[model samples]
Target: MLKKRMINLLATGFYTGLSPIAPGTVGTIAALIFALVWIQKYTISFAFILIFVCGGTLISQWAEELYGVKDASQIVIDEWAGFFIAVFGLGVDKFLLAFILFRIFDIFKPPPIRNLQKFHGGIGIMLDDILAGLMANILLRVALNFF
Candidate 1:
């Protein structure tokens, strides 16, 4: 059972959902690594963004069922998807800014973000992050332009 659980968590990206230290941090790092590696060759960031969004949705739903829990902390695919949105194509050179923005959006869940979470199944799991990501992107864009 323990081995199986570990496999499940690893498959879900290190049980990042259950991380006490910094779940978002773990998820963001995972997402960044993916972006750097998989998206390195792609000139268009939009393609990467779409892939993350769609893939994250399917993976999140699978993790939800595997974990037999809704919004399980061990499932960080949502975080991965969310982080991508927050940092994708913002032209922010600084990693610190991306980190801050991703965390803020994940935690705050402003407006439609909170509303999106009310959705059922994998879509609900994914949509909330999408909203949060969009909010973070908008905020980050504004901040970058200002500063």
Candidate 2:
């Protein structure tokens, strides 16, 4: 069906998230590669970036239905969007640090990140990762001040 195809294309990170182990990590890695190749190289406007971030919510929610499970591991677009949030305007130099921080927050789900999961559907799925990215970005920004 078209929905299955759509989920396969978008939610799976073009099937990159379909990696047998650590799919979320794979998705994040895909996002990191994208940031280094395209996002960091080109200076897109905040408005355009915001469009992707906001659009993720819709696609993620739609994809959730096809998976039949809340925040399924197969749905890694959230990871992609979160990594985008983590790096946003940061340089490639900060990639490692930002990635570690984002991964920690995403994996551990401290505070509001865990709380966010309570919401229904895609809002629930994407919001926590978005928050994790924000948290990681904040930490990266702080570290940038010192280093």
lDDT by residue (1-147, candidate 2, tens digit) is 887797678888888878999999988998888777785457535775677777777887888887787887888888988887887778778888888999999999999799897898878878898899999999889877997
Alpha-carbon TM-score of each model against the true structure: 0.79, 0.91
On the 0 to 100 scale, the lDDT of residue 4 in model 2 is: 73
> What Cα-based lDDT does every candidate model obtain?
0.70, 0.83
lDDT top scorer: 2
Q: Give the TM-score of candidate 2.
A: 0.91
Stretches of model 2 off by over 4 angstroms after superposition: none
Which candidate leads the pack in TM-score? Answer: 2
RMSD of each: 3.4, 1.6
Predicted candidate 1: what Cα RMSD to the true structure? Answer: 3.4
lDDT of 1 by residue, 98-128 (tens): 6677677778876767787778767888887
Q: How many backbone clashes does candidate 1 have?
A: 2
